[model samples]
Every structure is written in C-alpha cells, then in structure tokens.
Target: MPNITGFLFLLLLLATEGSLGNSKNEVSHGSSQNVVGRPLGNSLNAWKYCQLGWSTYERRCFRFFKTALQWIYAEAECLRYGGNLASVHSANEYAFLKKLIHQGAGSAVKTWIGGHDAVKEGIWLWSDGSYMNFRAWNSGDNQPDNYKKNEHCLEMNHGAVQLWNDSPCYELKPFICVKK
Candidate 1:
C-alpha cells in the first residue's frame, strides 16, 4: 500500500538524517548508552550535550545532588563540575526547579539554593553575585530571622509548598547545580 511505502520512506529518511549529525548540537536520551554509537537523528534532540540524569530546560542543564553538604562545600562541588548552585531568574524557572527538587530529592527534604546573605546580614544575594530582584521568602517573623545572627544561607522546600528559609551555611543539605 502507499501508506506502508510512505512510512518506510519516512523511516529511511530519519535513519539517514540521524546518520548525518547536525553542526549545531545533538540531543540524546541523556545517557551514553543511548547516544554514544547512535546517529544524531536517532535522538529526540531535546538539548545538545546534556549528560544523563541532567535535565535540559531553557538552554540550561540542571542536576540535583542528593548528597547533603554544607552550602560552601556544595558550591565548590558545583564549580568543580563547571557550574554553580542553581539561581532562579523567573517564576517559571523557580517553579521548574521546585518540581525538580521535589521529584528528585522529595518534598520533605530541605535543599540549599544559591541565595545567601553571607556577605552581610539581611542583604540576600545569589552565589553568582546577582541581587535578589524576586522574592519567595517564607511567611513573616520566621525566615531570615537570623536566629542568633548566624542563619545566612537560603534554602527551599521549607514546610509550605515552595517557601524559602534562611539557615546557617554550615548545615549540610542537598543542593541543585546548573550549567549553560
């Protein structure tokens, strides 16, 4: 039938295209086993060069670390991987990250983000040195409470949905890392 022939042709075309990789970038199923020997066209091409377990969204690759570590140590580890702690620039990004954390780490686990007031009390900033133009802090009188003047690192998944809280940087917690 013509339909069967057309489908076979389409498959052939896809196989050819996959064999000839694009110069821009190749998107794969996020694992070497899926990508290493396969033709580029065989991939879904979601985002170029995204490693396995790393989610690609908005031209960035995000990976959530389940290992608990101090805020400073977490930042260092992200840097080692050629990225930094995840920074939220928009509500959509925040929401995406919130879902990612909850799905990857769980809703009950507290996780450290990039925001911190370590340089100065009450002056929160992201690890990338960006000022806080967006606010998602927890409800009043509790967060950024600077308990004993020591709580300075920012974290999410505190009690309510996606609220943030200020805790001491020394506390060990899982973190999110981002790469572009």
Candidate 2:
C-alpha cells in the first residue's frame, strides 16, 4: 500500500510540475498554493528539482531510458547523465520505479537496475552504493539461483506483477537512472 503522505506528495508534485511555466524545472523551491490541505513550503521543497523528462520525488530525480543496453553499458549511460543505474530501498520505491517505466514503455519489459553481486556470491549491492535492504526477487523456484553461476546483475519484471530476477550482466535491457 502507498503511504498517504507519499501519495499526497505525488499529487502535489504532479500538480506543480504540470503548472510548469516558461521557467521550466528550475523554479525556486516554494509553494504558491497549499498542497494536500497543508502548506508544502516545508523542507520538501528546499532542494532543486528534476530536469526535463525526469520525475522528482523527495528531491531526487529519476529518468527512464528506453534504449536497451548491457548492464555495464547502462551504468555508463547513467553515469553520463550524472547519476546511477537506480536503486530501490523500499516497496514504495520499487513500485514508483515500476510505474515510472510503465509510463515510458507502455508495456511489460525486463529492465536493468543497479544491483549486483559481482564481488562475491550472494552479496548484492546497489551500483550507487545504497544498502541492499530490500529484495523483490521473483518468487519462482530456485529464482536468482545464480543460474549457471553466471547471473550477477539484477532486472525488474514490470507487468501485472513486479518482481526482481538475476541475469547476466551482458544481457541488453532498458534501464532507469536516479540522480540523488
């Protein structure tokens, strides 16, 4: 379930973003109107927001790239954009990401994320160095069993259901990048 605060914040962000005038995404952080029946002039608007084609949440910006690329190549592309290949710390984040991709692709497709255990077996870490405290691994038999011990990268399955699965880094897939 989505948090009420987060849901309200999303609505506020959308409403604010939709009202983008000639200035675009660089407006100073402040509220010209109340958000969710309360002033949103708090710390929530204190940081710089996202750029064009990016979505902002809690001051972070995320963009979904439709180009399919290998995991390493995808990470490189994300780096070029001044960010990482994206990391998920909670179910809310995971859901938000899935929704982000769906808004881009309009269909289910395996997408690369920033998780891997390349350094050691069973030791997963986000490419951006975020803590790997959440796992949405597909609940399939022997899922992410390091199939043939060659799968070290992570991909999210977004469809009627969303879940994570391990795959080889060489696999090409579209990816999401997060500017923290």
lDDT of 2 by residue, 1-46 (tens): 5699899999999887777632323344365422121112365435
Q: How much lDDT does each candidate structure score?
A: 0.79, 0.81
lDDT of 1 by residue, 147-170 (tens): 898999888877755578898899
Judged by whole-model lDDT over C-alpha atoms, candidate 2 comes out at 0.81
The list of candidate 2 runs beyond 4 A from truth reads: 1-45, 158-160
Inter-residue clash pairs, candidate 2: none
State model 1's lDDT: 0.79
- The candidate 1 region of ten consecutive residues with least summed lDDT is 32-41
Top model by TM-score, which number?
A: 2
